[model samples]
Target: MALRFEELDFQPTPMGEISLRRRYDPAARQDVYEVRLGDEYLMSSLFTAAERALATLALDVLDAGPDTGPDAGLRVLVGGLGLGYTAHAALADPRVAALDVVEYSAPVLDWHRRELLPDTAGLATDPRCRLVQDDFFRRMGAAPQDRYDAILLDIDHTPDHVLHPSHAAFYTADGLRNAAEHLTPDGVFALWSDDPPEPVFEATLDEVFAERASHPVRFGNPITGGESANTVYVARGRAAR
Candidate 1:
């Protein structure tokens, strides 16, 4: 029998202290995984609808255009590796040629590399995916030498509620424009938010991309036994250089 609770890994990072934990849920009758940054709960395996949607929705939009086909061979960049759900979902698509997952915390990468999460086992060894240790926001602000067909962000809670102050600029028009510059003209940029769709951020996306839309992903809350929702914002057709 699996232990009811266990802390897999814990370490102090420049951002703060982060930890990974596993617990057996009597109600769900399965093992649940969780990630935490200091006292804040970063993510849980129980609620991953939005994380998976962040990848599938972006890939759908990237492949929907007439310019793409079954053999699109798309390159993708994922800005977070929480539980590896988004990356796993992206890898399921045959069209993804390469996937670069940027995680600011090295301990988090080590967890996946060690296969701590059974659901995302083999993710690190997969030839199509690379777990990169770097600040995702910094990468977005850098040169666009390695443009991607799709860029998905799931690091922060929301535009208003960021885990770090440094991520505030990303919700602004200028910040979004910089992110757009790193995408192919027909490429897509997507974000996952714990909050409902924010008009201000959607408007910023509008300013940066020729097309933009927001989606609300609702799933049954394993803890609450009610539906919980998260927002996914997808933008395509970069408007500015």
Candidate 2:
């Protein structure tokens, strides 16, 4: 279905078009995507603040390295490719050796390849990017042992706001155990949430990562603002053996 930008909240971007629908009822849902930015939400679209924090926090984790090589060459795994904000940010960093961006939505991928690539013009399609269309939770379990330098997540609005029930497993203590197996000790796992996670979720991270921290990103200020107070969870994995 061709999106009806006229009927939704329109936000101008350097790319094609982005619209948000805030009127969905109990059963109906909405998808939010940006013209030049990213798809912040699907059913509850229009939360770009959360997306930006997801990317920024991942980068911050990468920068907090005592053991990172002098070259800063690191492999990164980003679990969601909503509007490519995380991908774009990773590409901007000279420290990133490779970026594996996984997105499950085919239309979202097409829109990105067709609309975003042309509009952004090769800024994000660098040689370092490897876009994979797959379920992040499944991939996490199947990924090789201790492989990635960083794992950035923005699969849902928050740990509580799950779009797919299967994803709940990814937030469980056991799921984080699997995620830890995929990290290269000292590798970072950055998770973006619309709000601070539940106590159980926070505990799960503490149980899995060697170091755990949460950073709050503020939005909606004249000088530095956009939407809401997004939170980023930073967790470090054991060094790759």
Candidate 3:
């Protein structure tokens, strides 16, 4: 049994004030974990279908590719820590050899290191997963020499709707092209969006990737008593500029 409601941690960050909370949900009959940035609820354990999909869908493409073999080990870069759904999902696939999670908020990394949330408890200790405190967008812009087999992003709400103005550039053609430089030749890039598929953004993918797609992931919304959906954009084979 869990308490009715409890705030586990709170901290003021450069982005905004963030808090971690846990509450007992009568409908699910279990404890629900939530992360809130300012007044905005960033994520909740009550719904995680899309977050998990962001990893699975991206890796599935790799599984189907010609590179997949018993000796093929994948290196993945995850841009966002959130509730650890995406990280945990990436780890679930044995093909993943290394995972680097970049999060701007130090407090979020601290929470995962502290093991305050069950979903992320082992994230900090996992040998394969590295918790990095850095701006994901900045790293992408730098175009570090290191490359990854797959890059999964779940930071922004959407291309149109971003938490910070700095992240806005990432959705554009040039920014996406920069991100594509960090991927292996056949590597994949996957992003999670809260909105439905946007054709305009899909065109941006065309400018950067040879093969790209946007997948709509629908899940049950208990609060609305109906279905809600999110989009997962996947791209691979960087296009010649």
lDDT: which is higher, 2 or 3?
3
- Residue 95 alpha-carbon offset, candidate 1, angstroms: 0.4
User: C-alpha displacement of 177 in model 3, angstroms?
Assistant: 0.6
List model 2 lDDT by residue over 14-97, tens digit each.
433445332322222343333322454343334455566666666775653334565347778888776676677777677777
Candidate 2 Cα outliers beyond 4 Å, as residue runs: 1-49, 63-72, 117-124, 143-146, 221-227, 238-241
RMSD of each: 2.5, 8.2, 2.3
Query: Candidate 1 residues 1-241, lDDT tens each?
Result: 9999999999999989999999999877899999999999999998888899999999997663233564348889999998999999999998888899999999999999899999989899999899999999998888887888999999999999999999999889988888988888788999999999998888888888989999999999867887999999999996654
For candidate 1, which ten residues in a row score worst on lDDT?
63-72
Model 2 lDDT-worst window of ten: 20-29
Ranked by lDDT, the better of candidates 1 and 3 is: 3
Backbone clash pairs in model 1 (N, Cα, C under 3 Å; residues 3+ apart or in different chains), count? 0
- Scored against the true structure, residue 223 in model 1 reaches a CA lDDT of 75
lDDT by residue for model 3 over 1-241, one digit each (tens)? 6699999999999888999999998887789999899999899999999999999999998953235564358889999998899999999998788899999999989988989888657999999999999999999999576788899999989999999999999999999989988998899999999999999999999998999989999999877779999999999997776
> Candidates' lDDT values, in order?
0.90, 0.66, 0.90
Candidate 1 ranges with C-alpha deviation above 4 Å: 64-72
Most lDDT-accurate candidate: 3
Assess the local accuracy of residue 5 in candidate 1 as a C-alpha lDDT between 0 and 100: 99
